[model samples]
Target: MLPRGPRAFSQAAATALRPPSGSAPERLCVAELPGSELAYFAEGGGGGDGGRPPRGFLPPPGRCFSFCVPSGPSAGERVRAARLHRRAEQRLSREPFGPGGAAEVLPLLAYAGPSGSRPEKGFLVRDRRRLPETERALEDLVRLILPPPARLLSVYEAAAAEDGGGGPLWRSLWRLQGAPESKVLLGRARVAGAAEPALHPAAPHLLDGAAVFASFEAARASLRECLSVIPEAKAVLDLVDGCPVHAKKGDFPVIVIEGLDATGKTTVTHALKDSLNAVLLRSPPPCVSQWRKVFDDEPTLIRRAFYALTNYIVASEIAEQSTKSPVIVDRFWHSTAAYAIATEISGKIQHLPPVHHPVYRWPGDLLKPDLVLLLTVSPEERIRRLQGRGIEKTREEAELEANNIFRQKVEESYLRMENPACQPVDASPSREEVLKTVHHLIKKQCHFP
Candidate 1:
């Protein structure tokens, strides 16, 4: 059993897991905070009349987050009897319940244990009297911190902190209330395309079958459903209808260039096009590209479906282009799937769908690339290029700079892609050198002169 008190508690929490990455200073958990039960279940358990939780209290505890790592009395059995003993010295540092004052909050983390509680993590924000301002601030923070797929409706309320201060601790209400229906659909699986049955329905990104669309037909169905609500989807649907079900590579090779932003994809693809006299194409295929931002702002279902269909349209283009000369694509289904999978799952690289999970398999009906090259640069070099470009970064691009884990997941997704997995190329050198290396690979792989 873990020891109690401020010093021992701090050491135990620190040792329970590795300190979080990034350069943030270490802050210890409050001593009296104890664990999950003390923080959440004490003080009549938020009940008033008839022992029932108040209205607006999130229900079905499965959806709620657990706060503490199992330890001490809660170590071996259920922690129902443990109670927090509040001391005057252990009260929270501040209690900002002023009409319009901001309150201090802390981000919390808990380990998954054998007792079946999943690992839980999130921020605890103070509830405010000004509802509108509080809502807007929380929305902004959610957008900044979480990817679209992971965002959920939050619950805010007043509660008694274990220290006897009537401080509030809030958590996001997830999966049901305000989340997109597609989110529920996405998480229904074990992992996109996993053959094993999904035992845990509430698992966040451990989705089964497909993350976005399992097949082209599935993508078409989602597009058709969103036509009335998302008008821009009509263009995508029309492009899908006209495009062939499968695009067979023409007489020549179809080469695709892929990487994170500022990895010199534009420079290298253009150079390759010029050298090989290849027809260059990009997905959403210029026709639907104009509406890229519109769909990007939509839910993951609409966003990913739009991009997936664009790959089919590009496939048709590839068939035609390759017949005349070798084809070069700026980005294809690889970029679409890599970014989607990375954004859908959070935390470390290990949290990603297992290696060669069906999520990484190429769609059978879509045109497969003869060769896909992933451009890689040293982190310093990548940052240096981003600074030199002087263009605004996309949300994911900005995240790449701030979060190493997200960036690693994206690149790793590319590597794990099956069938026509990407071959990593060191792009840290000059543009000419990178292009030279790509040309050599294409010649050897495609037998192109």
Candidate 2:
């Protein structure tokens, strides 16, 4: 029988009720209740108390609700009603929606939908079909910026694709697997493009061939994996052959003798060259013969330039002679620097630019002497030697003789040169003693004996 009055109660009951999959009732019993919609209860079974809620709904039992739909007076009808009521009881037993309900359900909702997009860009969306095209693009880019036989490309790609924030763009471009020279070229380009002020300011100064090559190789290896993902990377790959560092043979054993005036350096160097079977050379090569006279007469900044330029010419001559024999230089770059520094100390003139400073010559390119002998003489001994020589006085010589304090500073500077190859011979010794010391020191230091 069905009892009914309220539509809301009937709808709730209808939605909650269900029958076991393959069951059917013999006859349906209907009832009409007051003030509510139809509510049916089977007459059979202990569940006849459908007018009241289920025992599971009683206080302290966790409140529950139940609905019943009476079946016809047949065994199947009774079974169907019992099953529907059981399902309703189960539904009402569950806890009602609460604060954490939304959180608990959110994951389930997300699982039912498509995954969301990434927030940032510039990522490789790798699919097997696109890999070949992407790789080809990257290869082409690498060739554009780097020369043939890309030795560092693999390294670059690896660094570029590294996870854990391991790869930086500079590393990828420069340190890729490629020829060292090519890597250097690429590294320069990348460094030039850096946004940081320090990197930008330092790039040009730091981009030497050796440094470039090293950085490029490092960056490539570091960014290698990332490079593989950049599909348009071909722009950085191709580059034309450009200038490269090359080695040239030059005169060996160019021994340059340098010291303050009246040190007997010229006489000692000439004698040493003769004894060693070495070619005696002088700075301000004969090619700049007139400039040599100017330097001796004027000692001004202009004259200094002439003297400096002459050293290069002498270097050229020595380079040519080096193939045939070792060259001994009476005075070379150091003499130029010493005189320039001395002049500046005297407050007589402004100093030369660092590039003009003989010490400022390219460390890799300058002519390295096999040995240098610095003749040291006390001021008294040096002045005495000048008197003994009967040499005519020049204005510079007169000034030097007058200023003993200034002269001491010059001597001190020479002594502090710190060049390992310089050997100091005491000029106060007897001529024979000096020669013996020179010969012995040379044989020991140069392994000529």
The clash count for each model shown is 7, 65
> What is the C-alpha local distance difference test score of candidate 2?
0.38
RMSD of candidates 1 onward, in order? 15.0, 37.7
Worst 10 residues of 2 by lDDT: 103-112
Pick out the ten consecutive residues of candidate 1 with the lowest summed lDDT: 185-194
lDDT by residue for model 1 (104-185), tens: 3433333222233433333444443333444444444444334454454334333333465432322223332243232221
Question: Distance from true position, residue 324, model 1, in Å?
Answer: 1.7
Q: Residue 276 deviation, candidate 1, in Å? A: 1.4
Cα error, residue 286 of model 1, in Å, equals: 1.4
lDDT score of residue 304 within candidate 2:
41
State the displacement of the C-alpha of residue 25, model 1, in Å, after optimal TM-score superposition: 39
What local distance difference test score does each model get?
Answer: 0.56, 0.38
Q: RMSD to the native, candidate 1?
A: 15.0
